[model samples]
Target: MPTREEVIEALEAARKKLLTEDAKKEFKGWNRTIQYYFTDSDEYWHFKVEDGIPGELINTEAEDAEIQFKMKEDTLIGLIDGSINGMRAFTMGKIKVKASLKDISKLQKLV
Candidate 1:
């Protein structure tokens, strides 16, 4: 169980990864509202990616998020920190995602 601060820190790292030059090219012209819902803490965090650049992490939900992730705090942190694999986690029932297959694949770019 990660604390809120830990989750935020992990998200900050993910945000930085999204801003890298390689990521920029890969995500070119992609824009979406991504939401994270931690089942353990009942906490929500979201961020908007515009033109491949991710903005600040907002500690609230996005009513119109294009992709939504639901998981435990540890799972969220693990995915962001590379300690856990997203696809494996999804297969193992550790994470739940609500998005189109395209968006789900795009998420592989972030986590």
Candidate 2:
């Protein structure tokens, strides 16, 4: 299990990744709100990616989230920090995602 701060830190790192030039190219024309629900901590955090730029993380439920992920705090931390692979986690049932194939594929770049 991970603390709230650790999960936040991991999210921040993902946001920072979107700041890179390559990331901008990769996520171009993408605008979506992604939410994460931590089962262990009962926490909700969401962020928007607009035209390749990532918005600040918000600690609330998303009004119209395009992609939603349900998992434990440790799983989220591991995914964001590269300790866990996203596809592997999903396949292993460590994470559950509610998203379209295209949307899910796009997010694979984040992990």
Tens digits of per-residue lDDT for model 2, 1-111: 676678889878867887888878999989999898888888788999999898999999998999998999888788776789888998999999999999877766755
Q: What stretches of model 2 exceed 4 Å from their correct place?
A: none
* Candidate 2, backbone clash total: 0
Across residues 1-111, which tens digit of lDDT does each residue of candidate 1 receive?
A: 777789889878877888888899999899999898988888899999999999989998899999898999898788877799888999999999899999888767755
TM-score of each prediction: 0.91, 0.90
Best by TM-score: 1
Extract clashing residue pairs from model 2: none
True lDDT of residue 110, candidate 1: 59
Candidate 1 TM-score over all chains jointly: 0.91
Query: Candidate 2: what lDDT?
Result: 0.85
